[model samples]
Target chain A: MRSDLVDHVMTVFGAVVRGLVYSMLALPAILVVASSFTSSDTMSFPPTGLSLRWYKKAFDSEVFMSALWTSTYVAVLVSIIALAIGFAAAFAINRFSFRGKMFLQGLAFSPLIVPAVVLGIGLLQLFAWLDLTQTIYPLLLGHLVLAIPYVVRTVLASLSLHDQMLEQAAMNLRATPVQVIRRITLPLILPGLLSAAIFAFVTSFGNVTVSAFLTYGGNVTLPVQIFTYVNTSYDPVAAAVSTLMIIVTLAVILTVERLIGAERLA
Target chain B: MKQSVLNRRNVSVAVLLAPMVLLLTCFLVVPVLGLLRSSFLPGSEFLAGNGFSLTQYVRFFSDSYYSSVLMETFVDGLIVSVVCLVIGFPTGYSLARLSPSARRWRTMIVILPLTLSLVVVVFGWLIILGRNGLINSLFVRIGVFSSPKTLLFNRVAVTVVLVQQFLPFMILSVMSVVTQIHPVLEQAAANLRANRFATFRRVIVPLAMPGVLVGFNLVFVLSISAFITPRLIGGARVAMLGSLIYERIMSELNWPSGAAMAFVLFVSGLGFTAALNALAGSHLITKGRGNAL
Candidate 1:
């Protein structure tokens, strides 16, 4: 009986601690989202009145709009590039028993392990050396390096779970390897590909550390622009922009959760 | 026929591997190599000059200010790792043991912070932890203080933001590993008349050690190399390796010095990750569990 009471107490205590931690983690973004609706000019919790004035300010500002456009085009390009290369790499690693297979996998995932600051400065130096710093190519290429690891990771996860027997049977039926992959392996891994694309897009769009160094001319990515702006400004317009970003992020994440299942994200 | 088949397979594999290998090599590997190379070259002021020299590295290592920045980074990393482990382990354990629906909601709450941009999240925290921000406002309203206190731009604010940013990684790492451990082992512990605490310490912990090590390494490496949090939140008060590298390269235009500092941070981060791989092997517990962010 005494032990049963102890067990009950422990369960309740664990739940409370979990609840507190979760709330603390979610609070910052929640506050940002909440304050975006503030009727007042300044940020405050339980904001005075509901208004979208700051969001209008965000939309009307040319700087924010241009940054958003830059972020979008770059992220789209990154997703496509990362998906194409990462898929081929992942497919080879999964389907073949080649020498240096492990090495290839290591190289593919190496960018994830390297610190962003290191990559940022390294890429900046490399681009400047090649006289490519002024172009958008460095930003595109840098983001590709960052985003490809996710592509490889997600694609690999799906490939492992797919049936190899189907591909083998297709080969035995005199189907060329291309035909087999196009018909069999590709169809099986399509969900993985879509999720990987979305994952890559979000990763590129949200990246700031590397983008901070690579933003040339007026082609600042949204996150970097936001970072620069927030450092100097205290107005609620920043909060409004952040709130909109949070909504979009939540939407993408929810789609991943609904379409592919959130477990796949992990 | 066998030789033809072998050649065909080789050709196909090579074709499939080319694009990713080329991209990673040209963009990622070469740039990192360039940084390392630049650090060794002689430089007049900010420009990296021809000829091999270790002057940049020597300058960084010999300067007390720079050395302190490196020390401060590691110390903050160590503290953050310990705190995350203490808090994240229990939450992860509870998450692993929870019913499916409950776990789903809980995991979302945990992951929401991670999915948002770090800059935006830090902004939110700025309001909450700033001088006239939520905490101070509430405290004063309740007569806890006479006036609002300056809470932002300090080590405490930086640490708070770092811990919040990285806690999800720790919890998810532990949760992934915890889920893999067979529940029957815990049942057996219960069958042996062990209480919950004893069972956790004796049975669960031994099995969860791999996850703990991986989580510690990840949190430590990430926190140490973090750039934005230390810059915006730490302000000018705290000097971390990341912020120093940024200032050197961006503001000071000292590529060799910046590269040297970056390389130092890289080597330390690499050391921690290598240690993690040795202890837990290449299969990070968090792999495919979602993005590590």
Candidate 2:
């Protein structure tokens, strides 16, 4: 009877804990989405009445639109570059044993260990010294450094999981190494590659620390723009822009869930 | 003939490794080295000279204000990490015990916040924690407070947002280890007449320590270096290392001072990471011995 009471209490305790964790993670985003539809101009709770005026304002803002564009293209560019570089590195590290191979692996993974603020300041100073601060190249390269580590780590995880027997069997059938790789190896690791690309895109899109320093003139990314905008203004328009971000992030995450189970991310 | 084949293999390997090596060298390694070099330059000659000096370092160490910022960053990180552990461990334990489908739904809820832009997340918190925001309104409506209070732009608001920001990481880290712990361990403890609490205290807590340690370290490092949340939520009053570094560079144009602060932040982060590594290593050694016993 005592054990039964303990179990009952534990069960109730667990449920309450679960509910709290769930609400803490999900409620803020939901509130932002709800408040974006506020008819009132001021930032009020329970959001007054439901309307989309803030959404219209967010859409009409040129600064927000351009920042969104910059963020998109930069994210796309970062994914492609990081994927290409990480794939080659992963292939070498997995398939061949060579001198400095461990060093190569460490270098690829180093960015993950370094603080993003340090990287941001370093890149900012480096570009300023070179007079390249005005151009978008620093942003591209800074994000590339941040994104490449994820790509390499993901691709390496994928490569380790894949069966090498298929490549060996293909080679025994008189297939060239390149042919074996293209036909057997590539297809097997394609999911990892796709996962890596998606991870890179998400990281690059969500980045602000590194991008904050690299942004110059009118070249702010969406997060950086929103950050600066929020500092000055505290209205529903910020919520509107944030709601849009939440939507896009949700779409990407849902797609990733469909492609690869979310468990692998943990 | 053997040498020629070896040469060809080496060439292919070099080709495969070149791009990654070059990119890291040019962008990651060189830039950091450059920043370090600049930090050593005299603050007066930071923009122009190549001469090495430790004036920035001296000033940083000598000044209480700067050291206080650094100390606050670590203290905040420690507080948030502890808070996340107290709250997040149950969530992870729950996740590990759930059915696969239920875990999937819960995992999505956890991961969605991580994938969303930090700016968006902080903005949401701003609205909810502001003067006339949701929590205040609810409190006032319930007569808990006579009026709406300015809850945002303070340490509590900053800490709350950071806890939310990093809780998913802690939960996932703990979950990864907790799921590895077999159910029979707990069952055996129960069979030995240990109650559920005893089973948890003796069987579960020891096993979950490694994950908890890892999650704690990650949360510490991330929260320490986090710029946006503290800046947006903490406002101008609460100064952190990341924001101080930003001010020195962007607003102050004091590259040497900023670079020095960056290196200090990196070193402190490295210090915490090393401490965690030591903790994890000792835990493994003890666990191995216990198994043998």
Candidate 3:
């Protein structure tokens, strides 16, 4: 009876500690979102009366607006291109036993292991030598390299979980290879494809290190802009922008959760 | 007929892989090679004129300032990794123990922070840790402190934010492996007259070492290479190797020196990853019953 009480107390202690740790994980974002609604000019938590002035300020600024636009289009393009390349590589890897398959797989996932700072400097130097540093190509290409690994990983997971016997059964029904892929394989892996695309999108969208190096004049990404802004300024406007970013990320996450479930993505 | 079929298969495979290979070669491989080449060049050349020299690398090694930065970067990585493991092990164990539906929502909470941009997350930290921010104001109001302390721009703040940022990766890694450990083993251990702690220490921890090592490797690599968090929170006061490299390349316009340092960082990261893998192979494989990894 005494040992049972001790076990119960231990369980309660463990639960309380776990609860605090999870709260600590969540506290920063919650603080940022709460502080964004401050009525005063200075950013504060337990905000000094709620207001939307900061959000209005963020929206009104041309720098913030243009950066948002740049980030959106760059992310969209990167996601599409990454999906195309990742899908092909993932499919080839999953479906066939080719020579250098291990090497190819390693190369595909190599970007994840390399530090973003290293990749950023390398691309910057390469673009400077090629005299293409002035254009938006560096930013697009840098983000593409960073984003592809996520797409490949997600698509590969999706493809591996897929069964090939269905494709075989489709072939036995007199379907052409293309028809088999289109009719059976594509629909089944659509969730994975969508998940991969979303992963690509968020990676490209949230990138700061590579974008910092590659973003040329008039082409700064939202995250880079916010990074620069917060370094110099301590205003609620930055908080407001951060809140919006959080909302967008949360929205994307929710959509994926609804479509495929977050557990599967993990 | 067999020859034609074999040729056709090879051709299709090559065609499918072509675009990805081309992209990686052009952007990833060529640029990295270019960086490696420049790292061997004289600092005065600015990546255009090429005279091969190890001056940049020698400068990095000889300069106490640069070497300390490198050391500090590794130390910071180690600190973050250790803390993440300590906190994440329990969270991940509990997560693994949950029902499927319960686990899903808890997993969502963990995943949410990861999806937010690093800049946004750091900004959130700034609000909380800034002078007159949440902690200070609350403490002062409740008479815990006399005034608002300088909470931002320090090693502690940087470490705290990094732990928050990377904890999810560690948790997810641990949970993935923990979920794979059969419940029957725990039952068997209990049936053999083992207590809960004994079961956890002997059965669960050994089984979970592979995941723990993987998580440690990942968090260490990421924390050392981290740029924005250290730069924002630690500022110039506690600059890591990443912030130093950024300053050299961006502010000073010293490509060769920056490239050399970047190369050093890459090699060290790779070295640590390999060392950990070897450690897992030699130790875990011999002792553990199955290859958990």
Give the per-residue lDDT digits (tens) of candidate 3, residues A108-135.
9888788889899989888998989888
Which residue pairs overlap in candidate 1's backbone?
A265-B290, A266-B288, A266-B289, A266-B290
Candidates ranked by TM-score: 3, 2, 1
Sort order, DockQ high to low: 2, 3, 1
By lDDT rank, best first, the candidates go: 2, 3, 1
lDDT for each candidate structure = 0.85, 0.88, 0.87
Q: What ranges in model 1 sit over 4 Å off?
A: A1-13, B44-48, B273-293
Q: What TM-score goes with each of the models?
A: 0.94, 0.95, 0.96
- Deviation in Å, model 1, residue B110 alpha carbon: 2.5
Question: Per-residue error at B1 for model 2, in Å?
Answer: 4.2
Per candidate, the number of residue pairs that clash is 4, 0, 0
Which of the numbered candidates is closest to the native, going by highest TM-score? 3
